[model samples]
Target: MTLKMSGFNIHIVFDLLAASLSLVGTYLAYTWRLRAANAMALGKLSTGYGIALVTGAAVGGYGLGSANLILSEIPMVGRSIVGALAGATLAIEIYKRFRGIVGSTGVIFVIGFTTTVAVGRIGCLLSGLEDQTHGIPTGASWGWDFGDGILRHPVQLYESTAMAVFLVGAVIALAVRSPFFLKNGFYLMVGFYAAQRFIWEFLKPYTSIAGPLNLFHFVCLSLIAYAIYMILRSKDART
Candidate 1:
């Protein structure tokens, strides 16, 4: 049941690869005229928006990530993509409200963000137990042992695969000029990511915050609610 891997820490390599691929994908999406309007609009945003996004993402990603580890009594620091998304959303919303900007400004990021996550998780998987992103032990035939002899659910791959599928679908939607995706792609991606993450949390061994739920469960729920509210609000505005 033990899955053997190279001793070298290749997480950094995959991280770089993910970043490179995301950049390339974003550039292609922009140049190919897929969601061109949104891409151009995003490019025209003031520098303040970028500052807010980076600041919020940095703080939230590390803050929530470290807090979760502390709560779980694990002596380590980490980063959470969910936290980054939440922070970025809050920061962007505040910026938009102050500047009177409306509608989803995140459409341009859907593909790149999804690509980053879909590819970055492979780093976590290869990082093995030290990454602390592995899942609880399972007897399933596909379970992988991260040098511990215990067959655990490969939760990282599960998430990666889910996001990859979503990435494909989103790309296709963009290619076809799907109206729903054009307007609500950002919300759809956020909701889908949160929903899938919520399901996968059950397979992780993180300490429970409320009975069966962990810190991530609450974060996921908040994100799902936010996405739903935004989508509904957009619909109401149109009507």
Candidate 2:
């Protein structure tokens, strides 16, 4: 559909808003929820995080560029958020292992990340076929036209809804202080998000990296495996 608003593209507006608000929300969430964690582990958290950010962005950019996904060809700033998340997770795990930092440092980020993705995906939906995030043609009643003649699956909206559900569920888990959930909240979030994304990847009209899966599909599988390992390892450690 032609998502024009007052002579401006609504998708661009949402993208800008999402980026701005997500940054602010992430900072606030970190301060409000992880201040104590930071205080307790004040050993180069900032420096390590800076390194992690750089490495994550690099890895993500490389993945997207190599796979030719969306905007990975535009200089150095084009990268998929999904790739960034996968790379960031790996980088953070490496940093944690090298520094011997223990415990879940990403609890607050669970909500922050989910909320950011949920908001940002609205822009992807509005961008529609112009953006590579659009799904393949479908005949469902809920499918969108996206300025194209063929109706396509609204995968962006599906992901946004999934992220929203995860955010709400995570908050409730924190409020209840579920032992396992609190302990492995980050893993749980990653596992759930990756699982959902893996399913949605099939709907997207992207180049496949393997026989039947795209780059994101492989990334999501890796995330799911890593999350499972983390959860199991945490259990074993407790035992």
TM values, all candidates: 0.95, 0.84
Look at candidate 2 and give me any clashing residue pairs: 1-146, 1-147
Best by lDDT: 1
Residue-level error in angstroms, candidate 2, position 38: 7.9
Candidate 1 error regions (>4 Å): 1-8
Best by TM-score: 1
| Residue 171 error, candidate 2, Å | 1.4
Q: Any runs in candidate 2 off by more than 4 Å, and if so which?
A: 1-9, 23-44, 65-78
- Candidate 1: tens digits of C-alpha lDDT, residues 1-239: 56566624578888899999999988887666554656655754789988988988898898888888989999788898888888888888898899888788888788899999999999888888988899999999999889978999999999999999999999998888887888898999999999999999999999999999999999999999999999999899999
TM-score of 1: 0.95
Worst 10 residues of 1 by lDDT: 1-10
- Collision pairs in model 1: none
What RMSD, rounded to one decimal, does every model reach?
A: 1.6, 3.5
Residues 43-151, candidate 2: write the lDDT tens digits. 4467767689679867975675456554233233345767878888878878888878886666656766787789988888876565567788887888887775778
